[model samples]
Target: MEMNELKAITEGLLFASGDEGITVKQLARVLDVQGHTVEHLLEELKYDYDNTGRGMLLMQSHEVFHLTTKPEHSPYLKKLLETPQSTKMSQAALETLAIIAYQQPITRTEIEDIRGVKSDRPVQTLIARSLIEEVGRKEGAGRPILFATTKDFLTYFGLTSLEELPPLPDDINTDDLEEEADLFFDTFSEQIDQSNHR
Candidate 1:
């Protein structure tokens, strides 16, 4: 097919998919062309989007492609993603969720050790929210339940997979340990302080 025709059809397919854009391999399979051809076409399309004053552009990550509105369009996009009443969790819950996501299959006791406090309430809240779940029981003396992140966690965070999580520094230092401890306290301390204040 002609280049213009290819671009048009590809854009049409992307639009038809809405938030889900056709990957290069999928497009190649559908068009009976090589994957490189589809990739070249996508590159050309991306250039067009960059040159033209279109309201949106294409993005690829975690083996998926998507057409998203330009960041400049956030004010309008907010009208769609925003809700009347937003759901929120305590900071303790957020910390527990992060730890579970990073160190999955870890037991409540391990989490407590990291946080240096009981994590029952936060773990319960995360489980209730479907962000974390009991993966299985640990093989130990007590056989405590192990927790891990759920698919809902990825969807909620707009991540296709947990592998997309940002990389952490490999170095270990006193500052790093102090920061982790501070984070643990900061997460739970505010709520405790607020209740104490009252």
Candidate 2:
């Protein structure tokens, strides 16, 4: 692939990898490039982010690199996290949250299977709002991260515990709960994507 295409794929992979980040070897394997080429592309990307005053930075630790918001932008990011209620959870987000709440420690694939659609945005939205988090990794192929509701979720919903969640209605319709989860990190990711080109 061309250098520009490689760079774009690298950026998208890093974003999709989320908090887990991605190793040079992984990028090389996926991009069909050499380690040095991956390194060079990363360096070039990092330099672009640095010089362009982008909202995100390419950060690496323990040989894994991920995209992260600039530290200087924490106040604004925190403001977004703090006021999640301002952007109400979409039906998709609510449905995803409900799934996670009832089936604590589930993987995104499982959530998606239940929802019959992708759950990335909703999961990201929940994590950004501190409503859900990775409790651990499920032991198996790829070892997907396991998600569970958080204390903040309990507080936000005025629930004493998981048991406090009311039983699902017998007539519940997944179709009715079908809406895009729109809040927090999804917006954050979009803004970062926009700033990178500015």
Which runs of model 2 end up more than 4 angstroms from their true locations? 61-64, 81-85, 168-198
TM-score of candidate 2 relative to the true fold? 0.70
Clash-forming residue pairs, model 1: none
- Whole-model lDDT, candidate 2? 0.77
- Compute each candidate's TM-score over C-alphas: 0.47, 0.70
- Which is the leading candidate under TM-score? 2
Residues 118-150, model 2: lDDT tens digits: 788889888987989999888876567799999
All candidates: CA RMSD (Å): 16.2, 8.8
Measured with C-alpha atoms, the lDDT of residue 193 in candidate 1 is 52
Q: Each candidate's lDDT (Cα)?
A: 0.70, 0.77
- Tens digits of per-residue lDDT for model 1, 67-127: 7778898787566434534255666777787677767888877776776777777886677
Model 1 Cα shift for residue 184 (angstroms)? 8.6
